[model samples]
Target: DLDLSGTVGAMLRSTGGTSAPIFGFGIVDTATDVKVTLNDTNAFMVKGSVTEADLGFDNFRFGIDDNAPRMIFEDFGGTTWQLDSNGNNFRFFQAGSVKMQLASDGDLSLENNNLDNVGVIFLKQQASADADVPAYGQIWTKTATPNQLWFTPDGGVDTQLDHTGAFPTTWSDTGITGAELETLSDTSDADSLHSHSNHGASHGNTLDEAYDEGGAGAGRTITVDDGSPIELIAAGPTTKVIDILQSGGGFPELQLRPDGILFGPGGGTPQDISLTRSGNNVLALGASDKLTLDKIGATTGDVLAVQSTLKLAKPLVLDKGTSANIDGNDEISIPVVTWLYLTSAGATDNLDGIGAGTEGQVVFLTVVAGKDITLVHNGTVTAGKKLMINGEATVTLDQDHDFAIAIYDATATVWNVLVPGSGGGVGNHNILDGSVHQDSVADGVTAGSVIIGNDTPKWDELVISIPGANILNVLGIANGETVPSWKSVLDGTNPAATAATASPGTSLISAHRDHVHPIGVGTTRGDILIWNSTPVASRLVAKTAGAYVGGDGTDVVSTIPKRTIVLTAAGGKEATTAGCAAAAVVEAGTNDVDYWVLDFDKDTDEFAFWNIVMPGNYDGGTITFRVYWTAASGSGTVVWNLKGRSYADSAAIDQAYTDVGETSTDTLITAGDVHISPESAVVTLNGSPAGGEYVQIKVNRDISEDTLTADARLLAIEIEYTTDAISDAI
Candidate 1:
């Protein structure tokens, strides 16, 4: 080995030829084996005594291929050092260190960087596929547009997802607004799962806060928004339902079942409810169970009531009307809550048994007028055996009408009359007899004061122990005693009393004593007894004299004034004609049929009669009448044939018409002595008409006699007469 201290450089050139030196530093003997090695300076150092430099052996090197350096090492024993393969690749390995590797394809890697299996932090290339790349944990798209950090799952592909909304690492649509997302930054970790500095107060998995029973976290609620549907699916049959349980007690408040939901009072067994979807998706209840809808706050013992008024569209009738006659044997059946009105057309009817019915069945019976309806149950008034009233069945409602309202009880089988007793009477006290009574007065009688009889008696009787004032007994007259007269009870006038058996005086001087006489004179019988100033005592008087001297001392001398009786055509009369058939008389008739007598068929219109009487002491006189017996202006040739007659029986006198006068057919009777003569002989008058004389002045209208205009009406009648009697003959 040779060593150089200074720069002594010499180059030995090789001869130009095909043969050249194989190495710069080489062993000449090619067959000899050589070894070159590097060692530390402490052992392989050369130390010289004459002016030598310190030698430090640090790095080694080698060259290949045209004398280019192949591998090199630098800075031995320093912090900054490196081993370079000089544009080649190399690898280093140990059991538990980071594997430093290099590939022949010019790629480098450090294996096992304290990450999970196949999970890596990688960088993707821009615009090219990253083949066989790690896809888990953190990644960088540094060479791509808008540089971003990507978190991918294992075996990541270009399955892109956006996390700008709702949740990070979750799928979301692009262009989402911020309001749709939860803030997940460290400044405001308002999301379901986030991390912050306050680890003690913060939830690790903020989306779920679990709690045990009786713990602080119990009763905490997790609310799901409507935008998200919560679905709890069982992994297998082992986990089938979701239960909402009562806090602390562990009782299930509600259980969502695969079939239905059960929710109610939650003690032993929460109300079991199930919905069954049958064919056609119909929901049906289980057999033997009813859907009971109850009012709120209703107790188990209370009855269910309707919330509003209940009106029935039809009448609630009980048992149908009995078609069969009501016999006393068969019991009639009835239903509850109805009116059973049974009308019996039979002459008589009786009620026996009322058939079975529910409680509150009303049965009404209506009986026609004059019907006999008797209740014959005759049961005593017991709890369930009696009807309306005890023994009321014995009362026969046979009078006129009867009606009853009865109710029935199913258990009792009895018809109890709600409205008892029958009404309808004429209210006749005579028929009521002793059945009716009233509170009595002081006496034993039930009505009226003791001192009086009937309030307004039709006939009254007076019984007296002593006669009252102004009362006299005519039977008390003795043999020689005088009898009291009307003057005894009157004031300012007294008549001389006469014996009870005194006969009428024969002489006029003696008869004038107790009789009323006229002031001037009287000579006829039936002369009215009146107060006379000349002879004071009661006196006999002649009627003509009494009437002439009137009691007022005025000379009335004329007879009774004639009274014209105007009888309308409707006055009472017997006519041979059924109805009047005259033209002129019909025009003047009160009604169409009320003309006095019509002469259409003269035999049919023969006679019209009036039975009347005149006052006594009246001499026979002429009788005038309304006569429609002749033409209004005519001669005797065309006369209305009618006659007038006055009769006082057979033994007395009668005036008769013997001629048919010329002017007999006046419509309005105006003539005085135009005689409508009877068809007999004429007579003259002598004496006054007597008492007890009923004269019938009749008109005989004979339309058969003459044909002019005999349709006559006797509208009125007038009697003109005079009084004739001896003035002083009494």
Candidate 2:
């Protein structure tokens, strides 16, 4: 170890040589204690634990020249050394196999780098050892080609490997020099080898002859022996006993041996034995073998006698032959029993056997058979279907009373009793005698009766009887007749009859015509007959006047004062003395009714009035009466009496008619003109009015001038006029 304790500048230096172990180096002030400096202002200090021995002097400077080996302290522990080059650290070790390499960042590396060889190196025993070569536990090797290791022994007493063959020869123990012999021994049975003579004999090859020939010691044979008859006595438990023995074989017969099996102590008594085979290999004991109790004597309580008062907590039953008898007197004994019977002969009389003492008391008896009860009643009896009393048992209803019976159906529901003959008779006949009583009230008869005369009468006959008349008296008449003859007597009074004659004493009025004549009394006419009145006309006219009236008779005869003379002229006395005596005679002033005198001048053939006082000229008035006029032979216009003025000029008035005609004609006046105004006359001009002077004017006539001749007759006159001109015009 080189110590740089008091180095000032350079302790060791070397110039650059070709084979020197250094390049360049410098000292770093790696002091942790005091700051070191090359100059006073440029000082540096290291970081870590430090001592004075860590640095030679506090501020000493150390350097290495070129080609010089420099020492380096790698770690502060001071056990490692490294080389220095230009202030970089390179670790080094004294052992070459152990290396320390420094990384760029000052990390150290210590590793071994080597390669192993390619073949197997086995640690084997020596080939010259006389002892057997020990085997090494299996060795794995690698080879370039497929190969194997085998061992082959040569022909010798001792086994040795023979190498005379190829590289992979098999070495077995055959034909080996110095080879030991392989011996096999069965060590499990060492004595089997010495005992081979007794092998066949031990496996049952020998036998005793006596056993083969059925001697006393032969193998047991399956056998069955008839068992000795046994006595079975059954005693202790009960007086009666039964035992059973099973049999095997062909009928499997059961035998009741006379020496019955004994049971109980010493088998003193033998039980009655019986056997019966039922089906399917089963056996049953007969009735004789059934256990039965003996009837004991009275002292021994034979009938299970209850001497004291025995109260039965439950129902006591005696089956079949079991019975009981009462012995003591004054005994109010009671025993609950079921299915007990009381003696009776006929069921009909049995109900009476229940004793009159139990009257009005309810008793329950269950009958085993149907139709078991027969009740006889002298009074009304109602029986349902379940109460099947005998037929001869009369159920009489002595008096009028209502009876009802209800029958139960299969479901035990009671239904109303249905009476026979409820439906009407067969083939629509009347069956039900509902009239059992005269005033019987039958309700709910919705259907009408079919009997002919009972309810419904024959066609058209009244079913209801009329008072004071028998229903037979009603007549059956066909419809649409006026009066049907009465089949029975008519009552009350008779109706009146009409007479057949017109005269009172005409042969006793035999077939006399009583014609229905109609006569008009006032303004009405209807059926009428002769009444008690005067006769206005005779029946037959007599020819007592000798000659018949030549024409329609018209003769007048009167007695005048003696101045009456008969004046006869050439043609007719046409007022021959027409103007001989004429006077205007105006009668004394008439009140409102007056007669104006007018004359027709026959000589002049004109109408003339003598002292005719005409009324005032009325403006509008109508006149209706008979007016006669005749036209004389004339060819000029004739002016007749007129009432209206002229139509052209109101001043022109005419008392005679104005006319206009085309021919010389004569006209007759029938109806007057209707004057509308005083100036105008609405004239229906009849025949043709003459057109010029000397023409005739015919007014109020219906004759056509074209068809009329000069001999037409005139009739009456009628006219209509307006009364109020001003009001009527509007």
Candidate 3:
């Protein structure tokens, strides 16, 4: 070797005592690019040279124990970072007594910490300058004393929250004082300064004294500034006054006027207010006035009165004696009583049980049972109550036992009955005198004439009965003469008969001329009756052909006939033949086949028909059987195909018929198509089978390649047409 190298290693010795090696050097993996250098100025410097590109980047690591890297510094893809791992593969770790970690899987864990164990995790806030924030901010602590908590403010004194007793120990609010509290508590002295105090001018006062200083029982006057004077009740002043003092402490007394006159406290003159009158039976308003009463008249000053009798239109009748008031001028009947007592008396009717009367007022007493009755005034019977007959005193009803009239004497308060002989023997039954209530018929005169009354008796009409005599004969009417009996006419067999001028007798035969009345004879089915010109009588005539007979009155019978033509199908008139292909079998390879064809006949097709029946059936899958119709002269055509499975029900068959040109294996017709069975499908061309025109109906079958059978068959087609011409057919 031509080159010469001197030092393989260099070292610096420490100048101070007890100092370890200040400079050192080491190499790893026999690579000089990867090494650690130590010097006095710099701490340990571990690095990899740029030449070590295979290491991806550079990594400086420190470790312990097996020297496994506990912390690593790396530069990868231009991003340099440090990674540290705890022995448990945790990315973050705390080296405290109780280990805590953030695992590589992003799980944060603390040893001996869980929900069931000590769940206290203090979350604290850093100090802030804001006054609203506490110096220590929020602290969550689960291990605090029961019902007791600590609270601290940033710039305030600490407080203890104690929930040890009933709600509010003390409360404070604006505008509230201890006096207000006393008012709220019932245990407080009721007479305290706060008790029911007037709230000054700010609120309102309940006392009328206008000030709070008024003493109890102090007198005060309320003066109302209203303009009107106060009004006092005109009557019952003592009872109506408001005594505004304690227990008869008494209000101001009012003075009375000795002369029954009242004056105001400061009045100008005296006024009379007395309410008493001095008359014995009168009411006078003035001090020097007098009222007098007499019988039914009263006189006071210029006043005068007159007495007149008042009478009721219908007097009440009492059959038995009873307590009841009688209306003034109204009568009460004591019916045939031997003894009668009149009760409480009055001056007017229906007032009391007694009859109303003034002095000299009269009432009547009657004995309806034809017996004498003694009447007594149960009220006040006196000498003035005596009845006088011929101006003599009497005590009983009149001997005639009819009625007695009496007058009341107000002076003695008695009724004086008039005796029978006193007033012409109580004229209950008066003789026929012109004076009053006299019959027109003479007194004591007896006759067979009916008597009428008018205050007098007279004859009105006389009725006489005769035996076994005719009315006309009784009237002495001669033959050929008529009597006026217009109001007395009678029909057959009436008891009371009335005569008529022209038809007096009952027989109608006498009033008509003789004539022969020939009755009608028996009629045949179609026979009509007509008038005969010569005999002038009705005779039956045979009805003409095509004519019907009916009644047109007694002898006017007529008839009209109609020709009924019924259309019946003519035998052998309509012809049908096979339609479609020459044979029923559709060979396997045939995709479509023409099966049935109907050739129409002009003679029968020109008229209406019932149907064109085509007998056919099918056997295949997805086979289409089509029916085509040609118009008369083959000018137009209509094609329709059937649908459904071979074993489809009637509804499916009907749907198939309606769904024209439909592709299906079976169910190829309408109800009228007459699908008797899967083997027999009779297509009935309902009445609309191209009637009145020459039509050719053809049936086609289109079968798929996979169809079990390649064709459909149509047997004979018969046209069921009516023989009747279209003009007369429906």
> Model 2 over residues 485-563: C-alpha lDDT tens digits?
3333343333234333345432211221333433324332322233222432212222222222222233221211111
| Worst 10-residue lDDT window, candidate 3 | 615-624
Each prediction's whole-model lDDT (CA): 0.38, 0.27, 0.32
lDDT of 1 by residue, 672-718 (tens): 11334222222222233343355544444445444433333344433
If both were scored by lDDT, which would come out higher, candidate 2 or candidate 3? 3
Number of clashing residue pairs, candidate 2: 37
The candidates, ranked best first by lDDT, are 1, 3, 2
Error of 3 at 195 (Å): 41
Angstrom error at residue 175, model 3: 49
**What is the number of backbone collisions in each predicted candidate, taken in the order shown?**
15, 37, 29
- Model 1, position 264: C-alpha lDDT score: 49
Q: Candidate 3 local accuracy as lDDT?
A: 0.32
Which stretches of model 2 miss by more than 4 angstroms? 1-427, 431-527, 530-730
- Cα lDDT of model 2 overall? 0.27
Q: Where does candidate 3 stray beyond 4 Å? A: 1-537, 540-547, 551-557, 561-607, 610-730
Segments in model 1 whose C-alpha atoms lie over 4 Å from true places: 1-330, 343-346, 356-363, 367-372, 377-386, 390-402, 408-414, 418-730
Over 225-285, each residue of candidate 3 has an lDDT whose tens digit, in order, gives 3443222222343221221222222232223422223322222232222222362333334
List TM-scores for all candidates, in order.
0.18, 0.11, 0.15
